[model samples]
Target chain A: MRVEVRLFGGLEKFVKDVRFGEGFPVDLPEGGRVAELLDRLGIPPSQVFSVLINGRHASLADVLREGDRVALFPPLGGG
Target chain B: MGKIVRVDMTARKVTVEEVPEKYRLLGGRALTSQVVHDEVPPTCHPLGPHNKLVIAPGLLSGTPAPSSGRLSVGGKSPLTGGIKEANAGGISSQKLANLGIRAVVVEGRPQDGGWYLLRLSPEGAELLPADDLAGKGTYEVTKICRERFGDKVGVITIGPAGEMMLSAAGVTNNDPEGNSSRYAGRGGLGAVMGSKRLKAIVVDSPSLFNAPLKEPERFKAAAKRFADILHQHPVTGQGLPAYGTNVLMNIINEAGTLPTRNFRFGRFDKAAEVSGEKLAEVAVARGGLATHACHPGCVMRCSNVYPLPDGRVCAPIEYETAWAFGPNLEIGDLDVIGELNYLCNDLGLDTIETGVTLGVLMEAGVIPFGDGEAAIRLLKEVYQGTPMGRIVGSGAAAAGRIFGVTRVPVVKGQGLPAYDPRACKGNGVTYATSPMGADHTAGYAVTANILKVGGYVDPLKPEGQVELSRNLQIATAFIDSTGLCLFVAFAVLDNPEGLPTILEMINAQYGTSLTVEDAMEMGKRVLKAEREFNLWAGFTRADDRLPEFFTYEPLPPHNTVFDVPGEELDRVFDF
Candidate 1:
């Protein structure tokens, strides 16, 4: 299965050559969770604060489907 | 002791009076709101002689408190027809505090229709004829004032939009860099200032952090501790300083609550194109600052200096302003957002209100969606005082009425800001109940709903929203009074010692033994006074509601409607 991943708020620093909001396809086993994706990106789970899957809040254990849009962020806040 | 300067515009007289016993403990919004409530008649016309414009600094504004340079401008709102207190970040608050000035109250209309400028210095206060500065943009006015007075003087001014008494016109002051972009921009306070024939206020003070403190050593210790608390926070110390407030664009977009196309949708596909990361890239390439402070002593430095392609500079494109002009109008370009932001800063209009008004105009087919050029041309019409421009300056609610647009996103009479209420229900409760009318800062539930700052409240659900908004609104009211930047809440909410440290600083400065409960009580008092003023001004429980469209229209991504009960909204102020 393939999932689309994007990083934001300097979380892009964790992944070389990937800019903010730029999506890249990642190959993972069927029913891969967010924790596995973080490990695949070489980003520690502690570094990423919030995770969104298909625009909904997801946890580390949430299963990812093929063609899912996943966005990872460092703790960021403004109004 | 501090003094209050009263400028009687009708008589063209300026008088300085000692701060009253009742108002000695109050500053910023607390002082301004109290002055407005005590002096201005509730039933009077907002733009008439009966309304008074009160400008005040926070309690710790002139102290060494970090990010404590907020200014509060209060008046009966021409836009909302209710009590309004609009806050801004600029050097004037600290200057005013250093000059021993508590509040500057502009009262009565000018019978002769002549323009004037109020000059405040350590020497005295005086009102000078400002006919030469009349009809100029805020940027030009600030520049001219800086040149005439020393460059360090803080000039707070309005533009032709205010001269025309447009409801969206906002009062603006300059940052330390002489960029007149910091605004008390909401509820049409500038129109109230304009009606008084006051074009600008030039504050000249030699000191910044020399406000008399009762216990200088204790205040210094508390201030140091507060700064460390801010530095230890990830959001304040790291993310904000790196990309500025515009950093929230991507996170909000990802959360599926970024109000797009004038709240017709939940998210904009091109959000990242105009986001903080992109802004930082473009600004640095153009020799502009990616991170700057709105005022001195601000450790967060969440402001940016964005240089446009036209060689003009918009000091900081804040998150709400960017969200307003970018996703709300369906314009994906940063330069366009920068241009609109610059125009608003120059013309003395609230960017949020102007963007939301332009969105309503687009909805009315006056301009097409995503047409940046047309939006620019229409916005420029305000300088010429065109009929269409007047409609634009009249704010979102008036524009909606003029064009018969039923889907206007407004609560009370003010336009809704960046977040879609349906998706961010806690903020929705805030928008519905805040006396200031659709002001997000009144109760920023986004901390909990989206950012997980204080704690997590389900953004998509209505549960635990009212309590979140209520507590935040109370805390925010108190923070606004302190004249500290509301951004401090990012750290203060997370840190256990935040509130206590703030109270200690206040106690050290004022010699008051206030507890945490007393701070909470102050917040409630401010809100109660504002609510009572609104009630006397004819606002009922029905006025505290999101528009009908929010209730019926289901936003995308989550397919959620604003489900917070109306009765619950009324309960927001039950304390």
Candidate 2:
């Protein structure tokens, strides 16, 4: 399965050679969990506080499908 | 013990009174709202002699608590015509607290059409005629006050917009750098100050963090722990310091909730051009700072200094200002956004209100969208106090009414801020229900709905939105009363020991054993008092609603409308 993964806030530090908002294509086995993608990207599970799948909040345990727009963020907030 | 200074503008007399026992525990928004609810008649005109302006430092303002130097200015809003408590991060609050002043109440409008300046020192406070300083902008007023008094003296002043009694004018104060951009920039409190003929307030105190504490050692330990909590949290410690609040531009755009071009779109094609990352890159390249503190004793330091292309500087252009002038207007230039923000700071207008007004003007074909130079020309008219300027300065609701633009984003005559309610529905609940009139800070559900700070709530859903907004509003009311920056909540919400640590600091300072329950109760009390004041001012549940267009008009990208039921909004205060 192919998914687009983006990082925001300080989470960009985990993935080298990528701009802040640019999405990187990642390939995962069928019925892959969000945690597997984070593991593949070298992101510490504790570091990523927010995960959004297609603009909706998602958890690490959530199953990922092909063509999912997944975004991971460090523990971050502002207004 | 702190004293309350009462200035009778009509009588031209200043008197210091002992803090009444009943009011001794209150500070910040609690103190201001309590005074306004008790003293001012609900039906009185906001600009009339009957409305009193109450300024207060929070309970922990002059202490060693990190980021606790916020000042609250409260009155009946000339903009919203309801109880208002607008606050700012500046040096004045700490100085006022160091001088043992709990609050300053300005009562009775001046009969004579002359302006006065209030000077506060270790000796006492006095009123002096300031007619010479009447027509200046806030930047000049602050500069003059700093030069005439002392460089360290905190200057609180209004600009020509306030002098003209515009509905969107705000009360501004100087930061440590003498930038008069730290403002209680909501609710037209500056117009209320202008109505009293009070032009400027110079606060002179040798002490910075000198609010006396009952148990200094205990307070110190608690404050240290609290600071550590802020430092340890990634949001407060890393993200904010990296790019400041404007960091949200890209994420919000990615989430499809950025409210581009006055809520017509959910995303901007050129969002990255005005994003925080771009801002930091440009600012540092131009010999400016990407991170600075708004006030002393602030550990987060989520502020920036952006040097403009014209050899000018605008400090701390936050996310909302960037959005209001950038994506909301279809302008992709950061310099243009910085210029608009700088103009609002000098003219003493609320940037949110002014930007929304400009968006309405564009909607009505008064100006073209994405035309930065034309927008600049219109804002100059505001500083000049022209008829068109007055219409624009009156706020987005008024501009919409005058121009017959039905898509104006506002609640209770105050403009909606950066977030699009149709997409971020929890914030929509907050906008529809809060007494503060579409204020995002009143109940920032974005923490959960989008940022996933405390917990996650779906931004695109109506389920659990009322509950999310209600809890956040209660928590935010408490945080605002404590004189801490709202940004601290990002850490405190995520940390389990956060609330108790803050309570420990308060108890150590004031010698009171207040628990978390008591703090929550205080939050409820403040909201109930404000709601009661609005009710007395003839606001019904109908007033506690988003604009009708929000429900009917579906925003793009997500194709969502604000479907949170009005009954759910009413139930926000049921607790």
A-chain TM-score, model 2: 0.95
lDDT per residue as tens, model 2, B143-260 = 8899899999999889888988899999999889999999899989989999999999999999989799999999999999999999999899988888899988977887889988
Can you write out model 1's per-residue Cα lDDT over B1-575, one digit (the tens) per residue? 79999999999999999999999999999999999889999999999999999999999999999999999999999999999999999899999999999999999988887899999998899999999999999999999999999999999999999989999999999999999999999999999999999999999999999999999999999999999999999899887898988989998898889999889888898999999999999999999999999999999999999999978888999999999999999999999999999999999999999999999999999999999999999999999999998999999999999999998988889999999999999999999999999999999999998888898989999999999999999999999999999999999999999999999999999999999999999999999999999999999999999999998889998899999998888899989
DockQ in order: 0.78, 0.56
Name the 10 consecutive residues with the lowest summed lDDT in model 2 chain A.
A70-79
Model 1's TM-score against the true structure: 0.99
Predicted candidate 1, C-alpha RMSD: 1.0
Give the CAPRI class of candidate 2: medium
Interface RMSD, Å, model 1: 1.1
Weakest ten-residue segment in model 2 chain B by summed lDDT: B247-256
lDDT of each: 0.94, 0.91
